[model samples]
Target: MKAVGTSESHADAVAICLTQADYKGHLCEGLYQLKTYVDEVEYGGCDKDAVPTILKESPVCAWVDGNNGLGVIVANFSMNLAIQKAKKCGIGWVVAKRSNNYGIAGMYSLKALDAGFLGLSFSNATPLVAPSRALEGALGANPISVAAPATNEDYFLLDMSTATVAHGKVEILGRKKLPVPTEWANPVTGALTPLGGSDPSSNYKGFGLAMFVEILCGILGDSGYGPYVRRYGDVHQAANIGHCFIAVNPNYFAPGFEERLSDLMNYIRNMQPADPERPVIVPGDFERQHMSTVDHQGGICYAKDLVKICQMLADRLNVTHLSPLI
Candidate 1:
């Protein structure tokens, strides 16, 4: 496939360096992720050396073994399979096992959106969430994402974690040396609060949702569940994480799905908000606005510390260092 946007070398360098610096992990562990992909593909992971194997298949559904390969590549393969099936059967469902962290869940779902289909993606993660009434972490901040196309090249994309907040947010706070809100997480204890906080009535909803993801991505996929999954950042053993992808062809059921979707989205945007200062917005408004600003600025704006870290990584890897634009 012809590449668009940033090249892999540039993008992976920035991503690894930033994640290592902000998340405060061993630099080698971060760099090892890229090596892992190459090793799995060229060595022994996939059936055809980096290519996933179909464990079971049907007209509209299939199960794939990632062969302990890189999560991103395996996820792309799974989603493409789902999209191809949906093109023929009007709907397609695919699940994968023995994968690793695949970065943003929305990326996979957006693949379907690019193919002019509704997309849904889900994945189980390393356990970091403390279920309601629990004292320790048991469930992961499993993520769910859905994307649907709209008229005029717009889209409605919702990508979020089941937890009250993603661990990456906490990592960002830590990098800035800021304390988190009590409802967000307990830094000292390392216990993340559920989506609804400590209240049993509402918190159970998040707890339930987390379990729902576990069932779909873990239990259903026959991969590890909850605490059974390897610890985050542990690269020694195979992560064996599970993921689910689904694609639905809106044209199969309705002739004007995009029109109705666009209308509803427009209506929601126009709705009045009780807090006028914080205007009511839809799931994808912030991302669209932010993307527009980035486009106007010419490129991404990285923090000074992140730039320094990337420079150090460049020196260590003997690659071209990144220069600041502003």
Candidate 2:
């Protein structure tokens, strides 16, 4: 990140998001995408110096201009602003334009959770998903993330992309030293393309969800909508991606919200499994487990090729290379 002209603080902020994704087992959004960020900067599509300004503001609402800055920085600023407003008004909503690739949406939502409030995050990305029955992509793999606090450090979090799979998985899996899952492979040709042998109903639902987020992040945020956003591989073009953050005080809505949510999650987690081996779990359970595993392991696992790539990047930038701890 320093090699790409980002300040030390800015690079740290970006590292937090990317590392969090890797810690949570979302490999596609982690170090695999760092090269893309570097390219985005070197190609002049993203600005290293970001001066995010509030274009419009009210007690409970705000509009932010990212100044074409780093998406992680822009998202952190916007979400923190929303958290401040929600503290006073019980609810706060913020939207940002001229942002770029914010690797993971869950980080912003978790911010509100840390603040003892519920959080909702939405973002529109590059156009990489074709709508149902369409031949080409018309909408991005727009993602929605929600985080709600429960009792005793438990929580409910839903962070997912609306597309069948993020485009990164199509190529980055090989780089990550992982093989494709056979569940989605074709029985005849043994071919696997989540977007190619896609399920119509799932894509239909995904398309609708993508549009819903696009309206919040793109249309309302006044950034490019659908295909108007830059292509994922086109670093020469500015992404101008948009994002939305909503923070709410759950206590204001009803009493015992956290307690009730805790009860529901616990009961479901303990439910009997039909397979007897695979127990039912809630949305955020796997992430918590992954985080615990990462901590226990004391470091993240990276493919040797990815390590080599990072070393190559460090060499190009005249920086110290990673020590290859893994």
Candidate 3:
């Protein structure tokens, strides 16, 4: 896939570049697809504008109208606004409606962390989850993402859907032309399992969180809920998905919030290793490790087909081509 460099520092640049590629590859693709068929797009009554004006509207927020513009670009624009507001006013919030798939929630939350503010993001997706037991789909796999700064290490990012595994992970597998893990999907009915999904492991906890997000983003915002929510990538229908973002300045609660966060994390770090070599892990640990691996390997990997699709879109938009990460 195409990649580009930014003036930000190494870590910051890595995060930014990855997010940029993801936006173009995932979100932009969906937007371009939607725009082809739809005549008018509405975002809380606002029409399309470049990324800048979208961010200026602030807390009451703004919408893309998508006309259906790229939801990824729209979402990226909106989340960036949240990060900016948090940096200046100690917190920022944004919610997006009539937007399509905007890629990973972590990418957005991490934006706030990169900007030195704690980032909190949540979005409600089309209904794919069943509450606890019943088979019929009634709830969503609503997801939550958070990122906080850590002085001794990379930022701590926690990104997960309330469901057992995010539908995105499943979609990633589908994109790979690979079969989903046996545990991850129901073999018999082709239905996705909920967080608890009969495993009784951490799935239930995820399921609960998914429900919580559904309420916060969907119910609270008065967006479509339950069976009414539409699916993504469906050219025939509009995606009425909703999202919520909350950015908080640690300095507001305590003068040395970052220091305190580091200290608390240190305490957890020094705990006896479950295995002497493996050591204990914390939130954001896996993603941080993944980033390092990608760096050493010279670049991150994306599905080759997806890369081609991105090139095709870049050609269509007449935007300059993006260089590969390597």
Candidate 4:
């Protein structure tokens, strides 16, 4: 656990970590495929020069066609385009297909906000959510993430999966060989409980939100939806999932947006906290805190076991080794 300072600075630390991690074979395969995508699409569009221009361009709307490449690399490039475009226009959006799993949505959203724009990102994944009372899985544990700069406090970040519980969380518990909370997942059937799946019964709303995200990313992006989405570990071929992003400059909406935002933020911070020992914190608070801890420690703590796996992968890839970015 770490406590990071203001959000913008914290984001810079995260960027360093991601870049260092990438250089160490984190997403090397995917990066190569992405470069190829740029080549193939260079001469296919608007300006005969547009394709070539895009290939050399730093920011433009693009479809990764990951070709089963690393989702994290493709996603980073795709969102970079959105942020660059947003700087020029009031808002910019991008949709992706044939992409693999990106580690976290907030990772991408924060990229834009770090550049002074409100950032939004979402992705469709393997179906692991149930709709309504039906037990069959019909949706992905899709996630939506957002980030915005703050004047007097940390950047505002909201990252959440639309499912009762993300599939990753369940997998983590399973990996530890621990019994998942009965409320967290269905024990006998091995299904995720709906959001609020635990106690007071709030899963119906979560189920609805999951469907909403599926429609936006899967349906709108022309990616298949429902149970038709394939699993990552399935023996079958890789799933060609979809993602969507939007970045906006709030100044386009009204004058002094930052000042107004700062005012509202202070009000929220002053509100009574549920626990006296813990102050009321807003979105992005915990992440900011964690980043600070890592900085002081000179890097994040990776479990010894995971470090061995990473080392093995790096050795096999023979990529340039990178030290951890704390």
Highest TM-score: which candidate?
2
Residues 1-326, model 4: lDDT tens digits: 01112134323433443544333222321122222222222322101111101222324454444444445555676787788788887777777666655656777888888888889988887776666565656677788888888786457888777776666567657667988886667676666766667434778887777777777677766665767676534523556677777889898897877787777777888999989999987777766666666666765565444456555544644544446554
Give residue 215's lDDT in candidate 3 (0 to 100): 73
| TM-score of candidate 4 on Cα atoms, chains taken together | 0.74
Across 82-116, the per-residue lDDT of candidate 2 in tens digits comes to 99999999999999999999888899999999999
Residue 43 shift from truth in candidate 4, angstroms: 31
Selected candidate, larger TM-score, 3 vs 4: 4
How well does model 3 score by local distance difference test?
Answer: 0.60
lDDT scores of the candidates, listed in order: 0.75, 0.85, 0.60, 0.62
Pairs of residues clashing in candidate 1: none
User: Model 2, poorest ten-residue lDDT window?
Assistant: 185-194
- The sequence of per-residue lDDT tens digits that candidate 3 reaches over residues 42-75 is 2222223323234235443443232333345556
Give the root-mean-square deviation of each candidate in angstroms.
5.7, 3.0, 6.8, 9.1
How do all the candidates rank in terms of TM-score, highest first?
2, 1, 4, 3
On a 0 to 100 scale, what is the lDDT of residue 55 in model 3?
A: 26
> For model 1, where is the 10-residue window of minimal lDDT?
20-29
TM-score of 3: 0.70
lDDT for 320 (candidate 3)? 64
